[model samples]
Target: MERTTLFHIFAAVLFLYNLPACLSRTSPNITTDQSALLALKSSVTLPPDHILVNNWTTTTPSSVCDWVGVTCGKLHGRVAALDLSNMGIIGTIPPHLGNLSFLVLLNITNNGFHGDLPEELVNIRRLQYMDVQFNKFSGQIPQWFGGFPNLVYLNVGNNSFSDSIPQDFGNLQKLKVLNMKFNQFTGFIPRIIFNMSLLELLNLKGNSLSGNLPANMCNHLPNLKFLDLSLNELEGQFPPGLQECSNLQVLSLLHNQFMGHIPSEIGNLTMLEKLYLGFNSLEGEIPNEFTNLVNLEILDLQSANLTGCIPSFLFNMSSLQWIELPYNNFFGSLPMNICPRPLLRVLVMAGNKVSGNIPTEIGNCTALTVIDLHENNFTGTIPEEFATIGYIAPEYGHEGLVSTNCDIYSFGIMMMEIFTRKKPTDEMFTSDLSLKRWVSEALVNGVTQAIDSRLIRQEEEHYFAEASCVSSIFELALNCTEESPENRINIKDALALLQKIRLEFQAKLSEN
Candidate 1:
């Protein structure tokens, strides 16, 4: 009887010991995924300050469902996502992660991860969103990436990834966004890329990718809304491909080797809000067809060989806000109907040889905040409205009024006014006591005396030291406004002095 009882006790103990193991295997049926995750955890070496320190410990080894960054499928209890973005984790991506066959989204962006993307990633066939951007991943992107049938978003940008983009990417018919920017990719863009009619955003910016962009761009990419192929070596006449991209909102082709006239067919992209074609070899006039882009907001064509008059239609575009056409061969007069839109704010036309009178109608452009028309060949007597709107330099009326020194003197006077709140033509300043003379005496007495009382008494650090720098600026401004225009400090010298003063002021502020 005693021996049988002992035998029964031993049997019961063994059964209890085995029961926990059986329960563990059955409750979380995703052991393969759990092991893969644990393997991935083992591979990562956390930085000094990381969130994975205490929570990711082996204390509760089996239930990674409750772990940080792991989201599980409700029905199968399998890990469906692993997002370790911007975590400051340093390590190579472990291929074991591919074992999570149910993973739908995997994001490990802005980490210190390096090395090539493992070929095993092809096993994650369910992956629909994968972003490993802004990391140090290198070598050619895997050709097997096309195996992910459900992939909707893939961004591998800002990595050191090199080699040609795989032509096989065209097989991802369901892909909506493909960003491969800031890499060292080369060779022609695959002809098959535009065939994916569902692709809404395709960004291949900041690569050395060379060759002519396929002219049939608009044919297949009917749904492509945002296409950025900027800072590449793309050449040939500007693609008339925009004819089909009617849904396109933003098109940037800057810093490329593109030549020939911008095709008038660009007007076909009626949905375009921002157009960036600057820093290319593009020449000829702004096509009158651009008037069709009634929705255009920001238009930049700077540093190209573009010529002819500034288009009147551009000034009249109701939605136009920022217009930049600097460093082009554009000539004739700037358009006078600048306020037709009333939304016009930034107008940069510097470095062009555009010659004309300052439009007296400019007073109507109340939204004007930044207007850079300097370095052009504008002539005719200055408009009285300009003087009334902003204080004019004393030398503006003199011969050689358009010289660099005149601009410098004006800048110096503006700086003085900024600090002292005293304009050049203030009632307090008589013929003997000019704004410059009043400021110079204040500098002699102590720069603090001339500084605006509100500025001098600020509760911020280095206020006195800042006041002293302001006094020196006043001194520099006075030198810039010297009676002899030839003896005045040039703009270059004034800029250097200002930069030095700014640096000194910053250093003192930092010290406090």
Candidate 2:
């Protein structure tokens, strides 16, 4: 008629101009990938008919991205990593996850997820590792996360999230590992961790993080290594730019209210190993530059209002093992080379004023186990090589107690070093009577001669009531090492008979 009506009006304007590049701006018949997964389940908090859309039907949303733990990443094939860690997946967190702009690792760590955190995920420009730590996530940490330019590992630690930690995290220039510890985060702390130069492991320990710190924060984290600001309230001093962190190893400042005097340049931390300044208000001494902490192992300065002299270069710390310098004001006399490391284990110089004599080179330490010089002023004799060594001498043998069964032979030689892991001498030969008379002659000649054939485990099979709960905790460590301190058993009835043999060996290791 008019050239077939202008070829049916130019084929209906070329089918509405290829229908929005083949559909969906919001819904042409639904498709721009089903309206980008219903706009990512309407930005998650899902509920209404939420059977998580049963295999995302609306006719196969990108081939059901492999159901269940749904992990799918295949650029040329489609879908990208969405690891739902510990998926109990509760609400929040769903600004359509920035519509998975080719998501590259988004692990919703440890479930029960609560709100905030969705600043449209900084529009996920190819996101690179975002672990929503512990979870119940509250607000404030989202300053468009300093525009995550290929973000590298950001964990929202423990989570209850509060504010102040966003000096735009110094614009995470390819940041690496920033864990916000036990959160409730208040102010201070954001000098951009001194300027996070390729940072590595900075755990802000149980937070409430107060002032000071950050002066060069470990010389700008020169590849920082494990810095846990223990229980917080953090005050000043102490941050000697962590001696420019030459691979600093575990420096925990326990409790707080830190007073002065411990930085004799902390002997320039030669790969310092575990130095916890316990409690705090710390006063003098102890810094003979800690005899150059030669990879020192565990030196907890307990309660600290400390006064002089227990640092005989810490009895020559050849990799010293576990020495908690108790309650302070420490006077001299107990380090007769307090067992110069044959792997010395637990030598707590209790409460202090320490007057000498227990050192028979602590009976050549054969790895001493737990030696508390309880409330000291210590006089002589008990060293029948520690009456054979779990010696918590609460005024053992009183009135200058000249050893009549020395604190019941140092609690039957710390119950034969907790049942024969052995080491209690001073040469009383005669096959020894201490370790409490060989566990009452192995429970009257039978309960397998006081166990500890190195606590037996010959190809694990035995369960005679789990070997009679280790021979009833070696007869409650032979009734608390009795040499007859009025027939022993006291440190609160030997800790309620070892908590009733640890609840009968944890109810026989839960029935095998």
Candidate 3:
């Protein structure tokens, strides 16, 4: 019996010694994940009464899985995703977040988060989707981003990231959507990025990226549906191989320095819906092959120095909506039955040498909202159906020389119509009470009375900022519509002031 008691005592001692090790193996994983999340919470600066302030607590280890933006995997009970998007959280990301080994998605978009992304994020090898756009983050995109073999969607747009795009991005063979737009990135687009065959949406717009596009830019982008390189300094002839991207739907290369004939091969994109190649040095007639784009909705070739007759086929397209060929050298009469398609909305042929009487059949286009035919050689009385709405500038009545200032006057009227949602020819207006006069009087009384009610209803948080912005816009419009051409604000100055107003409005919004 003594021997049996000694055996029992020895076994109990061993059990006691191993009990702590067993508990450590089973419980430390959850404890470690909870600690990591707490560290992240402590690092961020939350807005007043933020949901995280109440929801993310350490009362229990299992409580983290119930936090606002945290998602835990059922199998392992580990955090699998962290989505703090639009939460207005500010601060540098804590390195402890790298402990989320099971994380497959991380989205912190539209916040005020600033600073370089933590290099420790390389530990989240399973991350497949990441969006950090519309923030204030700055610095070089980390090269280690290329190490995520499973990454599928990535967007770092609308931030202040600078320097050349990391060439290591080429290693993301599975990437489908890559957007780095509106940042300060400079230098040649990494050639290897074009080799991402699986890419569908590649938007590098509004950057300072310069260099001739690679000759074989579209050779491998077979799935590309949306390609926007607009507002850049990129220059060169159209890549002949772009036709290889048969699935392309929207191609926007506007406001670049490209100089050459637009390749006819562009017509091969039969699936294309919108095409914008304006504000470039490109010359020559639009390719006749463009008629093949049966799905085309918007075509913008303004300020491209293109010459020749405007194609009549452009008006006949059943799906066409906006046809912007302004500020070119096209000279010809508009098709008499100009817009047979009811979907057509905007027709801008201003600053061209086109000559003809205004088409009466344009009345058939019930959806038409904008018709900018200023600075043309059209002769004859304005169509009663077209001009009775009071859009005609004063210079037209006096046979004064047509100038860009005339267009400015019309632009002012359009802005008024857009904000007030009241046409110049509205029943409320008369010889004494014009749309401009009504808006001016309302501005003096209260700008909100002239602003669209929808704008006020939708932006309650930014009511003051919106009101101020609208007031400034109305004041600018009044300057543009001064009775005498000499008194009107010049188009260039008007544009600069409008941009300034936008910046100030954005600053106010951030403050709010």
Backbone clashes, each candidate: 0, 5, 0
Clashing pairs in 3: none
Query: Per-residue CA lDDT of candidate 3, range 242-292, in tens?
Result: 888898888899999988888888889999998999999988898899999
TM-score against native, each model = 0.72, 0.30, 0.75
Cα lDDT tens digits for candidate 2, 1-512? 12322333344334333333322223322233234455554555645554565655556554535444334433222334555677565767656556556555667788878878777768768776677889788877777788888776677889888877878878886765677889988778888656878765677778887887765677667766566777889787666657777766777888866678887777787777888888878778787877887997888888867788777777677987888988888887876766666677788878989786777777677566566777888786656565333363334423334333444445545656665665554243346464456666777886656567657654566546656776777776666555445676656666677788879788777777
The order by descending TM-score is 3, 1, 2
| Alpha-carbon lDDT, every model | 0.79, 0.67, 0.83
lDDT of 2 at 174: 71
Best by TM-score: 3
Highest lDDT model number: 3
For residues 200-301, could you state the per-residue lDDT of candidate 1 as single tens digits?
888999999998877777788877778899999998888767777898888899999988998888888788888999999987899998999988989999
TM-score-superior candidate, 1 or 3: 3
TM-score of 2: 0.30
What CA RMSD would candidate 3 show? 13.0
